[model samples]
Target chain A: MLSFYICLRKIPPMTEPRINPNVSVDCVIFSFEDDGLEVLLIERNAGQNRIEDDLLALPGNLIYEDETLDAAANRVLRELTGLKNIYLEQVYTFGDPARINKQKDQDWLHSIRAHPEARVITVAYTSLVKKSNFKISPSSFARQAMWVKVKEVPQLAFDHNALLEKALEYLKHKIYIEPLGYELLPERFTLAQLQKLYEAILDDHFDKRNFRRKVLRTSFIIPLNEKQKGVAHKPAGLYRFDKSKFHKI
Target chain B: MLSFYICLRKIPPMTEPRINPNVSVDCVIFSFEDDGLEVLLIERNAGQNRIEDDLLALPGNLIYEDETLDAAANRVLRELTGLKNIYLEQVYTFGDPARINKQKDQDWLHSIRAHPEARVITVAYTSLVKKSNFKISPSSFARQAMWVKVKEVPQLAFDHNALLEKALEYLKHKIYIEPLGYELLPERFTLAQLQKLYEAILDDHFDKRNFRRKVLRTSFIIPLNEKQKGVAHKPAGLYRFDKSKFHKI
Candidate 1:
């Protein structure tokens, strides 16, 4: 929207608190819903003066002089989408000098940044959240923040596509070793639902019997007495993640 | 030791290629030697006018404007310790606004850096090397680089002690899932030697029989037709890592 640019331009450069143009933080906030893995993205709407094409990107911004990288990531996510109190883990820092050298990205940067020529090295953070819990409200320069399916993510702004791939790889690897898969599921869940979550994240199909056998072997996934209440089919038993048990091992 | 300062001071600031003072790279290079897990550290000898106690820290320096983070890490490692062609993976980025806010660190920075007050966000890298393979010749401002046992590492410059701790945790976690331990061993090693390496890194004793049984279950460690020679103790059968088998899994 034109309002996004107008709002940014209204803030005089001299009056703004000094930001480290060379250092920024981008967050890949992922959620599992609609039978798939989805990532939060902000649509970069440059209005009428847009060059090349508009694109989507992770919620990100430069760190202020006094903020830590973690604080900056949380602040950026909150400022762009009004989402806060989410646990984010820093995954990687992409610091290629030519990361933002593409003409289209440079144009987008010029529209949004005061120092477009500064080499921005971004520290990327990834977090998983339940999609049903929070309402998406676009704020700051982001006019639209949406959860797009990971498989359907298009060509994003800057090096975001690459960042997304890295985040996905991290998520897939972490899901196997850590109890991170539970973040995307209900407090109590079925093995079928768990399989679907893994299939979405790993993009690989597993034999239902084998998947259950392997997962049940882990001490963290505790079987529960509860079952799916409203489903038409036979009710499957539920399971919950045993956080204390996981830590003990 | 004054030569270290003189060497740094010799580089005229104006003619120097612009460096990102706010971003740097540090390396935690680990090696298995002397019956313990060792880390490569450089002595920070701030000559005559030293305001604080001398410290040993990870090999690191600010990145140049044209380099990628990986390249900067390699450059920093090579420049500081005269070691090259080592594979380093980015583990974490330490970017607390107050990371280098300590008076001791500030004093040391004043003696070495052009912009000592810049909030440096260091991207830390970790690597494993065979201590017997390469000789370490301290270069740049580092007058003394040594392989100090991880257990004996002293208080470090900047936030390096915390960085080292994170790197150690990463190493401990990674050694379980990945074939990284091979990097710290010879081409052919005894099972006893392998167990010792694990004990040193994990800092826990494993029952000899159980450790052997667990490791032998893995397909990657191929039994070789070789054995230790000329030792006072009984000759132990040697085994080598199967790179192809490891990759296939």
Candidate 2:
């Protein structure tokens, strides 16, 4: 008679052939630029299954096994966009089965078929970063990384457009209570610029007097002795975010 | 070469498996009782290879193919607790592989091994319902269902205790803004009862006068011109929630 261990070993192990799928992280990095509130979009190389010669999409990559979700997101951001340590957050999980192969050319479908062992489930996250901080370079996957206005994001593949909309709504809600405006602004920015950022996000005009008073009332802004350059209008006073006061509220 | 019709049928056939094993949903339903905030707990049946005999656990089930996360949550609540149309929201996802088979019971491990098709990844959600509304009935897999005070909940099985703690914290944070207190209170309750509900959830002593003033300031409380009865103390004024103004803020 075989021993229990030997018998168990002899029995064909129930194989989890479905490769837990390669989990990837995608970042819809937003920045308030001179143009408007914009999201970073990267162009993907045109392949046999891709209809467009250069398809545009969000910057993201596959997560490593030994890393946490935040760590994976940070690594993907740095590797893809040369940006590091921004205010990143997990927004939502995208697991629609159709998202894997919705490409017009069926190139991605063929790629997935070629690597049967690769079942990739991507976790989508978003980051609000200062547009001025980084010099982005196109990785091997695309021609270049460019900031596109949020309103102008065109027919993106998969559920990216819906993801972007959710991120924008999250930002609007977050900005009301948290000091999220700092993520879009530089180390020193004028009160007008801050107001403009709010307007752009809320998509509504605010009385400058009321807006200034409300922001100042929060007691989370520091007056920096600086001014904007190359502006013909009256130079507005610069201010920086008071992290200590912001946390107290 | 095969004809076009034959090639179409044979090549790139849609053979994707419909059964997804790695996803499930667990619910933590909290109710406000006369004592304090309570959570619904169930006893797992001592069935084949199920080691958690007579142990307390949250009401949960595997996600179905034709349902959304919210729909699955509603189904679980209705099927397990016999309650419906309550306040429900997704809290977080738990993916720790060791969370399932932490006990070193060979029989339990064998049960899990037997079900090779089951790779459970649970997403936790929390719901708030009036304690009086539920009709407790144990399912085929459970021994019984009972409302256990959150503070008195025993060491639960499968990270359920941790999930309950997280849900309590989420409720505490949400009470300040969202109209979630109504979910726990009876349709008609006194001012003192409302204050006690807040105190129970926040776990902090609030000045009675101040709490009353703050709640009344919202103007979403309708004075029912009724008073508490069968009590050994002063009869407090009864009030009902103004549903139209509940979600205004």
Candidate 3:
């Protein structure tokens, strides 16, 4: 494997270098669908001429000389997908030297002008956004970017598969502490939808009675006067996520 | 303030650099004292034969080219304290660009030969260790390192004051999710001592009745058949932190 930085540095005229400068930012952008969770994956250089064209990866870029790691993560997501104003936070740093040592990974990096064997330490960030909130776009480095089902994703470019796994692991824990489950559901949602979202992400069935009892204790998941309709089954009561009560919960 | 790397890249020959590497690891080592939460503070290199003899800072260093950020953090802690096999985990990264702009911060960096004006993006890690389990030592960069009460700590070098606060904030949440409270207590501890530890760190009282009830729910805090003796007050029943039950909790 080669080394690379998951940075968002605005590379000035000095375009190519022999060794990797190392630090970069990589984003694992996640969204929820009716059936399961989804993550945004960027096709490896879709616009560029292809050698081994069957690769996909998380949206990432090298950190520039002056930009904050946070800024770099936001820029990478924005540039790759035209996504803006979404919730994103730094999750962890992936700094193993052997991360880019795979043959296909090396070939891909050579084509992109990154040192195939240089040590790259990526600052990985996880973002959960409403899929409808942003549109996808291609980059000079990535051919095309799209959101795919988390379970259905194929081998991603570089160490991104591991990155994706880590991101989800982080999300599972984050949703429990914060109200991330709300992000996956509609603005006005039924209690069933919220429970299903939790069950799906956690890969376990949450008892309906116990779930409601525990959730109500949080003081943030608010009940709205509205209710769900147009379903084959009878309509269910609706609820809204109260942002102001977040900290207190 | 002057920018620096939180790394330990055994500098081979290239001694001085004009620019900052941007990414490094900083360790905020914490231990529990009998009365309060204590944090490790390293006095700035007074042996450099220069100014600012009373300044204190966290134990941090720039990352070496080949080591992972995790390894760098551990090595920094080990090199400075001679401590090993202690609990350590990533807390957060402090990356505000203006962090190094203060005059005192910059002077200290110049004396150490790090980039005086470059931006340093630091990955901060927090470690909780038994003070008795390890002995404190100094590195080339620190004059002496010692544990200071978290509340009594004055202004620290660079952004370390902010770093220490963040570590404690992280600790508050971590103790609940995991059995970190046990690290601060003896093998067998009284309910009053346990409540005091919680109160001291959160700076708020946990009602005695509510605390005992709530703590009983956590499988990790086990009731011991022993009691505290030779105390000024009543000898309270003792409890133990069960490591085996950590995952279950």
Reproduced native contacts, each prediction: 0.92, 0.00, 0.50
The CAPRI category of model 2 is incorrect
The model with the greater lDDT, 1 or 2, is 1
Which scores higher on lDDT, 2 or 3? 3
Clashes of each: 0, 2, 34
Cα deviation at B154, candidate 1, in Å, is: 1.4
TM-scores of the candidates, chain A only: 0.87, 0.81, 0.86
| Best-to-worst ranking by lDDT | 1, 3, 2
Using TM-score as the yardstick, the better of models 1 and 2 is 1
Best by DockQ: 1
Writing each residue's lDDT as its tens digit, candidate 2 over A117-170 gives: 333445667888787787787654555688999988897755678778877877
lDDT of candidate 3 over A145-227, digit per residue (tens): 88899989998877899988888888877777787766667788888888888877887898899999888887889888876
Residues B41-108, model 3: lDDT tens digits: 88777444666554788888777766777888888777776667666788887777678778887887
Error of 1 at A131 (Å): 1.1
Query: Which regions in candidate 2 have their CA more than 4 angstroms from the true location?
Result: A1-19, A22-25, A44-46, A53-56, A59-67, A75-82, A94-107, A110-122, A138-144, A217-219, B1-19, B50-55, B78-87, B96-101, B104-120, B158-162
Report DockQ per prediction, comma-separated.
0.76, 0.11, 0.39
